[model samples]
Target: SADIIWQHCTVVLISPASALCETFNIKMPPNINVLRGSCVTIPCSFDVESRFEKYLDHTCKAYWSDSPSFTSGNAKVKPTKDMTGDLTKKDCTTTFNNTRLLPGKKYYLRLECKNDLKYTFKQASVNISVIGTLTCSAPAPCWSHPPALTWIPNRGQSQETLQENQDKTKVKTSVMNFTASHLHHGNKISCTAVYQKNRGSPDVTAETSLTPDISYSPKNVTVSVSPSGPVPENSNVSLTCSSNANPAVRNYTWYRADGDQEALIGTGQSFIVTVSKVKSTFFCKATNALGCERSRNLQIDFQCNETQEGQRLPQRFKTINEEESSKPKSTTQLLRIS
Candidate 1:
């Protein structure tokens, strides 16, 4: 007998009375925010205890719901999406690409981490809001810098380094160009200004609101190389920038190719541009008070200078051999009496 053992060996398992482990563990921060028509990621960390054994497929299942009060009149609950569970790493998080949000609206989001097997959730809820200007690329600026003006650096609206004029005014000049689509209606387009107030100042903003009444698409643009072809070099090669427009064209800009630098040959609708140097290529740009037209790159060439070739007569003025035999008496010409 082994120390008076019991008649039959009995097995008993003991577990801590207070240690009833919960299902999935979750933790999140407060005051998280998201923007409308944008995406949001909810961070979560979890340690799956042995309790979540049944729901194998639901391991990846995630649930999201909006506030019930938001849909008081509607039968359906608020906006929700599933499969947000970013279970990639040991620290699982959730993300949502929310497009259902309206401008200046508030939304509450809740995610339910449900185990399909246990039909229970380790869930969390958060309240987020939408603010800030609803900005997309504004109408590609309907403006351009004429040649007379100095060229500023090519800067976009977002990265513009603003500078103030001598009068302490903002140089809010933006020379950009792009086609306008139907989405441009009623949109608040902005201009970058040195003065913060000028950014929102009615004077600084282009209130005309790109309408069809304006020259939305360049129209009635007529380009001509005056005197047509064989327009001699070192002479006036006129270029006319004519347009049938409402506002009418106030200025003209001429662009020439194959020059050492970008050259503005002339201004005005009818440009009397003299060709001094060898003409490689020629193009004229026309613009009104509204905007500048795209460049018309033309091809042109120059003829050799006829005056440069051959010798000239001496200062003594040598007589021609043919003139000697045909000499005749010179008579006095009648003068006009006015």
Candidate 2:
């Protein structure tokens, strides 16, 4: 019979006197306060450089002081597009749904990762300040009474700039459209209109937000030929218009170069040009709660399907063998050989 006894510090601690037996690291995003009802990305990452033979396993944990003991049920876990417990690159992030970070309360998050050798690295807990919404307002909205410009001449300028006599731009409409900004980035910027039924009784508000890389103005404009290229006599030519404006399009107008006045082109996504022995030049213009913008002019040409000696054929003449039409021509050519 043999017995074995383990001795403490017997080899004088040959290995490095480090706290952890694993060689890996984990990190979290620096800033945490995020807007409410919006998606927030809690970025995390793992590194396993020392042991090439080992694999990477990543796991994230979140805790709120008011919540129960640290449990997986407290948070949602799902495999991202670039993770299988292998942390090779910096593509680790988690999105929290309906975050309820209390104000001035302590919150903690711990990350755990395992490798082929069972080595684990735990990160130092971080703190977060939950500010519901950080809105920096300038007392009241920069309101204006409307630009005093009498007219907008199309041939005048490629783009017109309007302003009030006080050197301020005053575009006074119920709805306001502004150039997208990061500060107003994905934020619920709203405006309350006090008029009509909404006057004096809790202003009627309209809220909206825009993400980066997205243009909030009129977009997705399309122009196509009706009945293909040219519409024959008494044919229907339809021109459709679309945009990315919110609240849909309140109204639309159709305009042509012949007149400065823009006629209301009904409330629909398309306009039809009825050709009855006559055709003209026209273009489409769209408007919404934001503003109105005109599209480039489109030319419609008529065709004379009659035969004329001076004009050449629109297409190359086919040989007799290829011609399927049995109709006789004004003159036919034939050759006789002896």
Candidate 3:
């Protein structure tokens, strides 16, 4: 039922004179998703009632029907040259070509022998869907050293299978379950297949890739002020807002926080403002088509006349005697301010 291989052949256990047609079944995958242009091989095997065992022969034919009715005359895919499994052995495994045109619908298998063995397995059906998925497959011509598959960036849960094609060739498939997010947008995921040779021959490798399209809101929004250090009161400074986003950020709105309320200052990526308070808090909002995000509060320090650099300069000055010794009788005026 899952992506794993089905080995055992199951029987329908139906009687000729009974109404047990619902018991008709087969062993195969329940669901399969493949690329549009690629082909797929369904591993199938089945068994009939013991009474009809004598009717099974090499002349038996396998037909894949789109409908469950036995008399619908709907033999859309008759695996004549591509039927790999031997009907005499009850293995109905088949391969269909030009799968790009196949409809995305469920399919049933119909078995018809030369004598009297005829039945449509309606209970066991396989649904096929064509789309782009994280399933990668490669041919394994040489089983001695089968190809090894590895995913680039090596993430997500994956399962692997070794299946047989119509020509009796082997194929190795790897299906990975991955979740898409903004963190991985624009990143390329690749699947590489490595094949090694025996007699010192060079190795062969094949690879395929997929890129996911992801859209997200703004992130890591922040506001930075020009002339970052402390500035004198009423000094002019520039504030800029920056953020990361897809489709680019549309606009930026600047906000200044006062005591308990916020005031809208301006718009655009950059804004010029005057520092009128001893300390001020500022932030910005970045918006795009998807959504918007607010930045953290940025505190700007303003230098005051008496408590900052203006008043500390005089107290740190050297005394008149100390300044004279260092200057060595230089003719510099030692004017002292009150």
Candidate 4:
């Protein structure tokens, strides 16, 4: 009679249960990918057998384990603060935090009820794979309509992804990527997140900024001479060299070019040379820790000759590009006397 009663009970249980003796079933994605240092959510739902209906309550808890053999009582990763799945409604959704520590592999879910309803869903497993590194992240709790993310001075190729937080809130992360260049140095890059609420609610926004440090060689090196245009013969003139560079220009050098030969004349931000009867070509070099640059040549010439009436002639100066430096000098007629 006992055998007959046991067989009858088994047959009755099978009618209400989804599978033989095991009526509980869970629905969730098979695989999930997330960025390192970020969080991810495993959306899940489940159905319980008729016999276990009495055990379904708010007191039920969810657990995730790395090993398939994990039970409700012996869970490998039971995040006390992060287990967000509500079992009362049959929602087994769970959010995992800081995926960097979780090894990339298959993980199993275990449910523990306040009473006798406890089961481990081994039929369907979730594989957590850490795909890439996180570049930037911002809170996006409004999952219904996710916030729009943008970068200031938008320079790089960006990709947007959804992640979860410890509090089970979704996060909108923007991975703006670009090759590091010296041009990006000292640039104030900002990440702004705009959340457009429904109805008539005002839009909410958040922003963050950072400046990148980059090393680069000297650039835009230029030389400027004082006492613009013509000057008296045998008078002193000032030449200054400047450049745009990181770490600033540490050294400044002045050079004189005569024909095919070049000679170093002085060392400083400014160089003063006395005008002479012979025409001359001069240039300055600005240097920093990374590299150096040479400015265009400034050609100084005696533009005027003494008149028979004993009037003194004036001197003239002009800068030429490097390409024109090799060309022969041309004489200039006296336009006027100072």
Q: Which candidate is the best by lDDT?
A: 4
**Per-residue lDDT of 228 in model 4:** 67
- lDDT (Cα atoms) of all candidates against the true structure: 0.36, 0.36, 0.62, 0.64
Native-to-model Cα distance after best TM-score fit, residue 299 in candidate 1, in Å: 3.0
Q: What's the residue-level lDDT of 109 in candidate 2? A: 36
**Alpha carbon lDDT of residue 80, candidate 2?**
44
Question: Which residue runs of candidate 3 sit more than 4 Å off their true CA positions?
Answer: 1-133, 143-145, 163-170, 210-213, 258-260, 307-338
Identify the candidate with maximal TM-score. Answer: 4
- Model 2, position 187, has a per-residue lDDT of 32
Query: What tens-digit string does per-residue lDDT give for candidate 3 at 1-338?
Result: 01222121111111111122434547875544443344666778887888888898887888876567653356756778444588778888876654522332356788987677888887676654322236677878777666888889776777888888998988888876543345555566677888887778887787766555444567678776676655566768887788766657999999988977889989999989787645667888888875577787877654344654446311111111111111112122221100
Question: lDDT tens string, model 4, 1-338?
Answer: 00000000000000011122246687775455444345667788888888888798877888877566767666767755346666788888877676422332356778887788888887666654222211567666668777788878777678988888688977777776554444555555667778787789998777666555444456567777787667777788898787766667899999999987889999999999988788899988877765566787788887555778888765666766422122121133111100
Model 2, range 212-290, lDDT digits (tens) per residue? 2211233333444445554346667676655444324565566554556545544456778765544455665556543
lDDT comparing candidate 3 with the true structure = 0.62
TM-score-superior candidate, 1 or 2:
2
Per-candidate TM-score against the hidden true structure:
0.26, 0.28, 0.48, 0.51
By TM-score: ranked, best first: 4, 3, 2, 1
Candidate 1 local accuracy as lDDT? 0.36
**Which residues of candidate 4, in runs, are more than 4 Å off?**
1-134, 164-169, 178-184, 308-314, 321-338
What is the TM-score (0 to 1) of candidate 3?
0.48
